[model samples]
Target: MTTENLLVELFVEELPPKALKKLGESFASQLFEGLKSRGLVGADETVTSYASPRRLAVHVCNVFATAPDQEIKKKLMPVSIALGADGKPTEAFKKSAAKAGCADLIEKWPNAEDGPDQLYVANDGKADAIFLRSMAKGTSLLVGLEGALEDAMAKLPIPKVMTYQLEDGWTTVNFVRPVHGLVALHGADVVPISVLGLEAGRMTQGHRFEARVDPVALTNADCYALQMADEGAVIANFAERRAEIVRQLQAATAPLGLKPVEDDALLDEVTALVERPNVLVGKFEEAFLEVPQECLILTMKANQKYFPLLDAAGKLTNQFLIVSNISPDDASAVIGGNERVVRPRLADAKFFFDQDRKKTLESRVSGLAKVVYHNKLGTQGERSNKVELIAVGIAAMLGNEKLESAVGTAAKLAKADLLTDMVGEFPELQGTMGRYYAQHDGLSDDIAFAIEDHYKPRFAGDELPRNDVGVCVALADKLETLVGLFGIGEKPTGDKDPFALRRHALGVIRMLIERDLPLNLDALLFVAAGIRGFSEDVAGQVETFVFERLSGMLREQGYSAQEVDAVVSLKPQRLGEIPKRLAAVRAFADLPEAPALAAANKRVGNILKKAEGEMGTDVAPDRLVEAAEKALFASVNEIAPQADAAFESGDYTASLQALAALKAPVDAFFDSVMVNTDDPALKANRLALLNQLHRTMNRVADLSRLAA
Candidate 1:
């Protein structure tokens, strides 16, 4: 079969980055459906889409050369019968017959039982002019539809939009980004034919400067690889661009006795930055190293799109690798240009660092009062008070009396850097600035380190706080953020997380789990008692509410709702103990008969709930009579202490193992036993044993909520 390719290119001005990605994907999806809906499927059809700041292109290959070429029926009638009272088809029967093809095609419409039985008219020889006009009308309707589509996309909620090419004259297309050029093709033909007041065509301009108007011809469906290479440009596929940048980056920077800094996000950003990438090395004054290495590298990668070079010892080098759009003839000149741009960025950073050094850590602490924590909660000063409370409470809970005062002191100043000049200029340096200021102020090693460590695990898989004071302050800070925001009804909903409460909650979880602190979340809530955001009663309530939210926040770390519920049900005091409980439940979950075990746990729960529907805590153990009941009772009594010890030792699996030993005995007792005996004492004893079994099983996990 002979093949033909249809390429449509829509040239516009620069489009928003976000819109470029969205429009390309949306236009392709809609066009595919539009053609299919028109009953025009090309034999073995395919479409390839491409986009840049200035243009959008799509190509279709192996088109049918013509549509199915099926006959379409048409008919006309006298104005009185087929037309309206004015001029068009008048009678329903006549209009129906005309629409169907002819009067006979309607068959015995008003007379037949089958209803609307019509003649099978021969439409193959019908004149094309009739439906050809109809097709033109459809095309006009489609133009309107595409206009609406563009308006809808522009109105989509986004952070920012740039509209240099909006045809409506106002120009600012309200989108996360701007919409630039668009080209759409269907088998070498324009699909909707017109969009953005521009007709779609087969010609595409390449690489702005390289291909210029090279036609980007394709023998089949468009592949940008050859087109880009022939045009002295890089093909802009992210994956291909990433591979090329990395390979050449490694080769280019190797000669400098340094390796390219491994920053995945920066690498991904650079991959999107250029149409054709040319990796080269750039250098800066080694004296810039006097500034914090983090600030130096952040200045480079964050602003200049450069990757910092590091030696084998992992020390920052004076050199960096830069990915450039243009491959220059003089590599030295390009490097010189990059050095000039980056020099000022690093200089400002150094100035900020030096200015921050003048203030004592204690002086900076007072400035935190000006930082807004949340609108509902007052200022960072009020928030810091709660952190101090949390730190003291966790210290007491963990029996770290030695660090209690120190933890309190550190927590008070942890966020003080937020108001510092260094952090103001470089928002990423909030915690690091605290540590630097603390050191400059001649604070003790522990306090300065605590200031730095408090914001640990800012993201999932990031490092956690390493010191006692750091862990305490970290928990206080996170719990305050969570409870304060959630109390004011600022909880995250759908895709909106206005306060980053989820990340704060996850940070708390990671700090607790990784630090292994013996802190009770409930007790921490009590310390948050002094917190100014909500009532004492509501504060306690918010803590429990935020606990569930925290568990949800840990979802990305691989905890499921069932797993989270089971952990929460155990009433683990320290967030650190959650992982241990999660591991135990996960292990129990792996067993083939885990479903049965969960059933056993739930059965124990249901029996106690029914018996003690209104009973208070502390069931009396002496009211036994049934032999089966007494046997189960003694077995549970024997296992509770051992399980308790195992749990205290953090051997959750061992605790469950001890509790499961009663499973066989309990199962036997259930088979041979009659719990609801005539005597209320025996019934109460059975309920008490069930409670003991439930409580014992809960020592490791509340298996009732766990999934089989």
Candidate 2:
């Protein structure tokens, strides 16, 4: 085997900026694996992926020019069908061997065991079979590379395919964009392969406006990136290009004691849009700052792909940074061009803001009737009414009149911004514009913030609502969405949550737990369900769905599966208490008596489940006949009150620890006493006693779930 570095490139029209990173990664990895599977590359070799606006390429080191030969085995007919009664070859054996290209072995017979093509008898697990062994030739680079290229191109994660004809115009090919060239090289030699109607070559075009050469010619496999940069004026690697953009941004902003807005996604998009980046400063009139900084920043970044600068206080500045693809001695025209384009966009935002405040959020409340939230669930107005009811109920549970009033008002006006011009233009600013408009309407800061913060913690690790009223409204809003959608049987299936029901459920869970709200989960669901006239079964399904999300969250936080199952199995109403319960379970598991008690608890549960009719926890004193049963009853009587006291005081750890004293009695009772006795009275008493034990042991968590 001989080894050398290899390079593969596909030149096409400008690729989708959002998908360039993934497309590059997929192409490189799939191509590498394809060659490795064919034994043309070592498993430990390194691969470098390069992606830009117009190309996706990969470089692999130490790839073999020829794969190693392999030994192959072929199974012929079974022994019974191939051999005669005296263990001699029959006519069937002769025909099979000749067809297998081993006819020489048929004539050689007994002497064929030592040749390149040999015959042997082996059992294939059903019956005896004859096998022929041969050597397979190695694959050359030209053949292996062609197969690898096809596999790689077939598996590219193209977001959307475009169909275009080649120069020959009769045949059409589909790709992310029109293919122009393909480059495949091993060392200094072209491997000579064709893909997507283009033949492999060393020639590839460079920057459209600033390349030193018309078509840069690569000299070797290892110099593709450097040569492209030096002669073609293009930074061929995506990560390297992104790093250069970051460096220029920092250099451009450091002199004024300002920083560019930090958004990885925006930075990646800009990096994909440019080949060679030149950072320049551009500015708009300071009057545009009268609009909300979020609106201006969004317009500039989203529409123009410019990096907005911010002062040390995190306030937006009038100056912004532009990443130009071409560098000229006089860059005034480019800077002016960008500034001219952004002013109209900012003016539109300011216009929407000025016009939306002309009417109060309360006035727009009636407009929600025209917007259908869901066909089965009525309009947004109806949804807001449901949320208002749920919020008041939650506030009443908290026993605060002021909070209840604020929650009701905020819930009514939360969705009013859906009809506002600012939000209509930028749907991402729904709750945001509500806050601004509420402030302009002479509302208090608490109410205004609540209107904005109701959609807090929208995604994972996001901030929760700030004030108590915000908490109530946020909970109410999420619960309404969950209950309403679930009532219509539009639950999330698999990964397709078109309505983001899972996010709503998780948001509800976070508020209940993080705020340590003193509301019962079932009661809250019931309140929302009642408002929508939903059945009890819908409430139950929503509850299960919420708890499933909570279970996954707890596991992700590093709790063991057994510990989480033990606590979640009980369906504790106050989700705020879950952390304390899990901590107590972990502490109880560390005790020396934990395993025995858990096992004994499991045994008692199984025994009581098999008893006739319903078992009561009323154990009569006179019916406790056996010594083991009597001792167990006595121990339960002593420990029950202490455990109940600790549990009532919110000391779950002490409560679970109190049950450790019952371990010995529980074990001895199970060992010496049989739960099912011939005497009806004794069996009934034992069943009642075990029921009492099971109930007492499970107050904190289901201990049986901890059993192996």
Candidate 3:
């Protein structure tokens, strides 16, 4: 089979910047996989994808002009149905062979062997079957590449598509942007395929302004990237363009003694916007820095697609970097134009800040009543009240009455920033604006900090609330969300969490576990359920959801699934104590006796589960009829109290370690004693003894979960 490097490019109008990278990746992966599945691509071949504002392309090396032929066997039917009296072909055989597109040669084919390898014999309730073998012709690159292009087009993650007409002005095609050109080259030969109403060609237009040639011509698939760069003034590869931008950013900032604000998403967007990037530095008036740097940065990055530079102290400077499409010889005109464009953006941010500070957070509290939190749940005002109550209850439980006032103040003002002009302009700065307003209102530092930090740890690995008041408020806020959403039967289902209840639950888990807070998760849910208009029945469901999140989060933090299952299966109320319990479980698993004890613990649990009723922990010595049972009872009596003491002292490792002494006796009891004896007294007593063992062994975690 002849082979060559293949290049496919779909040139369109400017695509959505955020979706460009994914679009490029999917185009390359899906097309390559489609070809490989058809045997047109070699095993050692590799693909490189290119994405820009106007194009999505892929280059594959070692692509075959024609796929290798495949040999396949077809099981027609049972021998009785497929063959005549002399083992000749029957009507059913002819029909089956025709359906497989090989009727002309079926009679010449050898008889199928009567063996287990034949697929149809077993299903047809026969020991023998008829089979036909044929060689399928290889598909030409033109036909295979067309199908691949169609499949790739169908799979692009285009949130929305546009319909346009080709040159004939009657036939319509749908794509992300209006389709302008298509390039499909197999070595130096055109594959002769069409997609999105455009015929494959060897020519593609380059940079809108900087191209030396209008339509760059490709001589072969291997030289596409180099030819485009030399003549078209465009960098086709997304990663290379991004790296070049990064290099320019670093070099540009080095002379100014500053660094660019680091944001991968912003960089990706800028890279997608320009095919030929020119990084330039622009500065605004220093007076605009009076506004919070967050507002300025948001306006610059979100609205203008600029990278705000920061000084060595990590403070936002008035200077910023712009990734422009054109690189002029003088460059001063570009810098002046960017500076002029950004001044109004910075000025608007400053205006919103100045106007928002005039209104106090307290005054804005009532305004939240008009904003609905959810249709089933009430307004933000009502939500804030519930959060306040939950925060107060948590503060009182923590025995910090002094923090109740601060917590209340913070929770009340937390959502007030949603009404601020600054926050209205930039919703990402909701908590931040509240803090600024709180400080402006002469509130204490703790209260101001709480107002800002209530939404801390908004995402995974985000920082927790900084102070006691903040902790109380953050917990209350997350609980209110979980309780409210879960109560209304809005629990997350298989990645469809419209309310972000999963994130809220993970936030609650992190605050409890990472902060070492003494809050009881069940108790917190119980208190939250008692709040007005909330259902108490959903408490278990909410608790399960939160613990489920914790289990997955712990596994992600490097804990094995078994360890997480062992610890989380107990549903320990104090999440803060989980790390210690897990530590103890790990330490116990390392001991020589852990396996036997764990298996015995599992056996004991199963035995108790089969009992007629509740088996009390009181093991009567008079009913200990077997020598093994007597020894086990004595061992439990000696070791359980020590384990209980260690458990009470929070020495989980020691508690689990103490139970190691009972492993041999436990093994003997299960081996020799009949837990379900003929005598009712003996059965009940044996169950009670096992119950005692189960309780002692599971102080830190359900050891049975550790059994292999």
Candidate 4:
């Protein structure tokens, strides 16, 4: 079979900058997968994707001109239905054979009782009569490419669509943008296909101004990228273009003794927006620096796709770098235009900052009354009040009554920034603006930091609140969200978490487990529910949700499912003890007696679950009949205390190891003892003995989870 590399491209009006990278990747991968599924390409073949502002393309290696022929067998109608009373083919069988393009073979069809093909019977005692067995011809590259391209286009992650008319003016097409050209090549030959009313060709437009020629002609599939660069003046590959920008930014900023603010998302957007990138240095007036540097950096990155520079101490400077699509001999006009344009943006930031400081954050307390938090949950003012109460209670629990005043003050001012001019203009600066305004109000540093840090750990892997006061406020805020939302029955289902309750739950878990706070999770949840006047049952639901999130996070952190299950299934009140319990379980699993012990523990759990009446942990040695039962009771008496002592001392590994000595007695007891004997006292005593063994084995973790 002969093979050749294939090339595909779609040239269009500039794409959405943020979605270009994903679109290109999806297009290439989907096309490759589609071809491979049809046996047109092999698994080992390589695929290279190219994306620019105006085009998306892919080059796939080792593509076949046609897919291999396949043998197909399709089961037709039931034998009773296809055959008439005279046992001959009926009109229905004729139609089916014609539909399958095998009309001439209908007369040759054998009866179900004596045919080479197998017959399938229906549940009604009727047999499916016809089986069409034939060879299917392969599709040529041109035809297969058309279907593949259409499928890939339909599956693109387009955020929005635009409708434009073709040259005929009567026909319109919807796409991410108006597509002007499509190129499909197999080796040196054009595998002609059409998309968005444009026919496939070998020529595509390049950079608007810098291209040496208007339409760069691709000679073959292998030379597309090289020709695109040499004649089109465009770096077609997205990753390559991004890397080039990074290199140019480094070379440009090194001489200025500054560094560009690092944001991968910003870099990718810029790469997608320009085909021929030229980095230029620009600067604004130093007076604009009086505004917060965060405002300046954010404005430069968000409003204009400019990279702000930072000094040696990571302080924002007036200088920034711009990636331009054009390169001129003087370059002064381009640099001056960017500087002039950025001056007004920076001036607006300074104006908002100045206007916001006119009123202290303390004065904004009453302003929250009109701002509704949730229709069911009341206003932000009411929410703040609830948070204040929760924070004070948490502070007391941490043995720090001094934090009550600070936490209350911080919680009161946390949402105040939402009403400020700076925050209104840039909603991402809510907590940060509060911190700045609080300092201007002559507030203590502790209170100011606490207000800003109250929303910490907003996402996964984010830092927690900085201090005890911040911890109190953050915990209160998150707990309020969980309790209030769960109370209203707005829990997340599937992928829809409009309120980010899962994130809040993970934040609470991270704070408790990472900070090793002595606060009990259940107590905090119950108190939070109480603040909202919610049912006490919400605590159990909230606890289960938090533990589930913890289990997933721990598994992601490289713990095995069994280890996590062993610890999390116990539902220990002190979440901080989970990691210790997991460590202990892992250590015990390495012991020589672990498998037998885990099996015994599981058996004991099952026996206890099925046992009738009250099964107490108290075992009377006098009631033990068999020597094995006596030996097991005696071993439990000796080992239970040692395990309990080690557990209380926080030596979880030592505690679990102490139970390792029970394997022999446990196996022997289960083998010899009849726990369900007719004698009432003896049965109860045996159940009690097993109960003691179960309790002692599971102190560190639910060892039954480790059972295979």
lDDT of each: 0.66, 0.92, 0.88, 0.90
Q: Which ten residues in a row have the lowest lDDT in candidate 1?
A: 128-137
Better of 1 and 2 by lDDT: 2
At residue 136, candidate 1 shows an lDDT of 18
TM-score of 3: 0.96
Model 2 agreement with the true structure over 1-708: per-residue lDDT tens digits: 679999999998899999999999999999999999888898999999999898999999998889898788999899899889987889999999999999889777656677677988889999889999888877888899999989988898988989899999798988889989999999999999887888999999899999998798999999999999999999999999999999999999999999999999999999889889999999999999999898899889989999999999999999999999999999999999999999999999999999998999999999999999888999999999999999989999999998899889999999999998888888988888899999999988888899999998899999998998889899999999999999998999999999999899999999989888888999999989999899878889999999999999999999999999999999999999999999999999999999999988888888877787988999999988789999999999999999999999989999999999998899889889988889998889999999999999999999998999
RMSD of each: 8.1, 2.5, 2.6, 3.3
For model 1 the TM-score comes to: 0.78
| Model 4 weakest lDDT span, ten residues long | 111-120
What global local distance difference test value does model 3 have? 0.88
TM-score against truth, every candidate: 0.78, 0.95, 0.96, 0.94
Error of 2 at 66 (Å): 2.0
Residue by residue across 387-449, what tens digits does model 3's lDDT show?
A: 999999999889887988888888888899999988887889989888888999999989989
lDDT of 4 by residue, 1-708 (tens): 899999999998999999999999999999988888777888989999999999999999989999888767777677777889987789998888778776666655553333333333344345444666566788778878888888888889999988889999899888999888999989988887887787898999889998998899889999998999999999999999999999999999999999999999999999999998999999999999998899999999999999999999999999999999988999999999999999999999999999988998989999999999999999999999999899988998888777888888898898999999888889988888888999999998888988888998988878998888888999999999999999999999999999999999999999899998898999999899999999889878899999999999999999999999999998888888888999999999999999999988898899889887777888888898999999998899999999999999989999999999999999898888899999999999999888888888898899998989
Question: Alpha-carbon error at 228 in model 4, in Å?
Answer: 1.2
Return the candidate ranking by lDDT, descending: 2, 4, 3, 1
The most accurate candidate by lDDT is 2
